[model samples]
Target: MNKTRSPIVQALLAEISTFDEAAAYRRMLPAGCYTEPEFFAFEQAEVFSRTWICVGRVEQVAERGDCFSWEVAGEPILVTRGEDGEVHALSAICRHRGEIIPCPEKGRALRCPLHFWTYDMQGRLAGAPRMGDAAAIATLRETVRLTQLRVELWHGFIFVNLDPDAKPLGPSLAKLEPLWAGYEATGVIDVPPAMSDTPLPWNWKVQVENFTDAYHPEFVHHGTHDFAPSIMPGDGVRFTDMKPGDNAIVRSVPMKTPDGGMMKDGWGPDAAFPAIATLTPEQRSRVTFAMLPPGMTMMFAPGTIAYTLIRPAGVTATYAGSDRVTYGGWLLPRSTIDLPDFRDRCAAVREGGSKIWAQDVPVNVGMQAAKNSRYLPEGIYGSLETTLQQFNVWLLEAYKRADQATR
Candidate 1:
């Protein structure tokens, strides 16, 4: 254990060390890992900072000079499309005095408001008003550049890492590659999600646990999720084998009918977006959900690939963007986009997502609140919760690796 870790974190890690995956039944993590501020801080530094984090889709910066601001592990970053036609992730803090630099308007240079220090699309210093002569300014331009973070594009999703030496992200996600081929063959376009202005009051883990848990849909989302039953007659929820070094914890549930998807009520046969003809018969019969921890979750449906971007604000505050959380975050084919009633379809999907989300809100609140209770049990997992167990294993691996690095 790292000596710098607080007593609470140390105790939590000590308990986590005793976890045995081979046991007949798996237990939930210590509540302190979810409720304590010290552990959250450690997680931010060790896991979020060191790992690959999905920021946005590559389509966001499709055109040269296009840029957007985002935060990763509490550090402000600017993702830009440079003149050279390469995507770049740069620190948004101005080098002169560390004021946050917002993305500039179209056809303009990024200018820090504090002193009007300007940087080109590539984050090279362009100007520093009234500070030096032309020669000195040229020297500053040559020397000053926004710190560049490592960026890797996987299936058009842009992932950034604060650790310069972090391993490549693609290999860790190899298991998800087979699922994408069908979606990519038809060519998908992203409708990026609008980040929620208000953070959800729960640990980020709780939000994901709620998402990955297959057992709850039957009880919690009774009316909304009946069509995609996790406890069906013969075929129900199926889980993917999570291997060592794998980053995704995935599960798929059979739809009541082939090609069924999200409708106004929720997951059903009358999908708002029409099914893609290219998907395999197997793909059309099931909906696959994959969680790329600490950052994103994806849903591979017959009609669309829905995704959610998670940004943790505090130990108990998480901001996310998805059809269920805010709006958009859909990957649809061009044919769907050209439909005259596309907006209506999108609204119906959001409505369905909202209904499902409404059911989740109260339970999430209860789960988060229980973390502080003395009565919080060492939870038991059922066979339906394989994804949750996989997630716990993933989290423990991350924590242990970070701890070992410090030692």
Candidate 2:
């Protein structure tokens, strides 16, 4: 397995750093990167495990004792807000004897239902009755703490890193803030997250690529054009077309109803969030969907804001971070959309996404199968796919570093 991957690994390490921006962006990642089981294992370990992955917005753990839980990269993680109003992410596996514990079950303290070993919301060993005398208990308490993962908050999003020493997620994504400035200034609130796992026979990157690039929306999401008229491709550049270091893929789309009618703006003049007063005239004409790859994205519309997450489920299935989707948002004060109506609108988008994803999954399945053909072209990038190419570069860099780490 190592021998087969040697050349691919080396090329990934070398090409990412040296690939000329001036050159044509016709090349694609190796087809095997999407189809090979061995490479998938490498990604689970090297990329997803080590990196800070977003677990949706902090709304999942907004109040004291609120919790969110999921399994990623083979490890079960638990996240909750403590009495002190601090959020913590920790190994959901109990420390006493490495037992698996189901989570998002809340109480004043986290109690392992199996053994009754208890941990505070902050993951401190709170109690283990009948284990010892005072001296022995003191020592045991010090050694039995939960394996805490690093948690960072940015613009209401919650990200947890399995690697305690990883770089700060904020500074790493500082440039992305500029992209969110207008929405942030308007005092955005999360819409209750809606998540669904779309099972794919191909690798997860296939979906990430689909999300980050504007190229496919032309054909794959052709229906989106009627509702999100910004997707109507033309000589103009799409917002998802961005350079590296931005750490974001943002696309601009018009706000339209399903029946092919354009709103005066995203929310219309009578929206609960009528329109952000701070948005420029041009900005008001478009709604923005922005993603920070692998897990987090926010769809900022004139009337409402939404937060979402996607994490890998094994090698082929992708989890919509909260199992099926937990989404929330603040309505623009001027907009007339009510909470009940807003909820329904969010549900419609979520359902629409699922419908669109059904189209993408088969397309990617074909791409995965096409790898076996001699005529399969390595990615031939178009100009609009700079964002997609940037994501590819980041993916290669991650694999290259992981390769180095193992050696």
The number of the candidate with the highest TM-score is 1
Candidate 2 TM-score, true structure as reference: 0.81
Write down the TM-score of every candidate. Answer: 0.97, 0.81
Model 1 stretches with alpha carbons more than 4 Å out? 23-25
Q: Mind giving the per-residue lDDT tens digits that candidate 2 earns over 49-76?
A: 8777877667678888887777667788
- Model 1: per-residue Cα lDDT over 227-332, one tens digit each: 9988888889999898888889899999999988999899989899898988899999999999999789999999999999999999999999999898999999
For lDDT, the strongest prediction is 1
- In model 2, how large is the Cα lDDT of residue 299? 56
Q: What is the lDDT of candidate 1?
A: 0.93
Superposition error at 319 for model 1 (Å): 0.3
TM-score for predicted model 1 compared with the true structure: 0.97
